[model samples]
Target: MYVTSNFTWHQLAQHVGGIQLQLEEKGFVKGDVLLAITPHSSFELILVYLACIEQGVICALVPELTTLDLDKRIQTSGAKAVFLCPNTSLTLDGALEIDFALEQGLETQNYSEQNLTSLIFTSGSTGEPKLSPTACITI
Candidate 1:
């Protein structure tokens, strides 16, 4: 499937706000871990990442989409939920289906520079994937 977007900055912000609300309403709270298995180049993936950031939820952007890879990620991240690609038919336990159509909003959160934001994993050429936790650093 092809991914394209024509959203302006204002529209993007609105979408992000809506996603944040969606996440909050779904019982996700600060420090909760989420696995984003959405397609790497998709706009929905971008929204998930931003919403998690604003909500102070730790998100791991999974690099691979295979079932085995996903299972490994879910296990290692201890994710509360998993975000899949829009057209995905895979049924995973704890999968969170997001509605980008939301317009409700929530207040932005203040995050510390040391706050764990995301987890980056290696390709595991040596063995099991190695994790690199990324922090929210404000310049």
Candidate 2:
């Protein structure tokens, strides 16, 4: 069951900062891609997403991906790492698994909409899935 909890603004900001620190420690820098393959969504995932944005790392969120699917994503996106929920039983090879706790910290960076921030895969009517990247730019 998904349990909802209340979080103050301060808590959220700190969590995001902690996540950013973790990402940096793991050698993930701006323009690097991270593939998150988990069956379910949780608060941690949201924090990671925010952290990636703050750090200028592109995050690709995948739901319940199989090994083959995971391989395709890695190849297409050139993801430097994969993130799994701490409680998950899945294991991956040839990719760094990032597991970090959200703690207290703060590090702010400028984010431009012109730079790619996230990636998604879209299936068309009659072909292989295509990668769709998102940026912050209005145009």
C-alpha positional error of residue 81 in candidate 1 after TM-score superposition, expressed in Å? 0.5
Can you write out model 2's per-residue Cα lDDT over 1-139, one digit (the tens) per residue? 1336777888778778888888888888889999877677776777788888888999888776677877777888889888875445678765554444456564557467776878988768855557899987732
CA error at residue 53 for candidate 1, angstroms: 0.4
User: For each candidate, what is the lDDT?
Assistant: 0.77, 0.75
Off by over 4 Å in 1: 1-5, 87-89, 108-112, 123-125
| Winning candidate number (TM-score) | 2
The local lDDT score (0 to 100) that residue 121 gets in candidate 1 is: 78
Clashes of each: 0, 1
TM-score of 2: 0.82
lDDT against true structure, model 1: 0.77
Candidate 2 ranges with C-alpha deviation above 4 Å? 1-4, 86-89, 94-100, 108-110
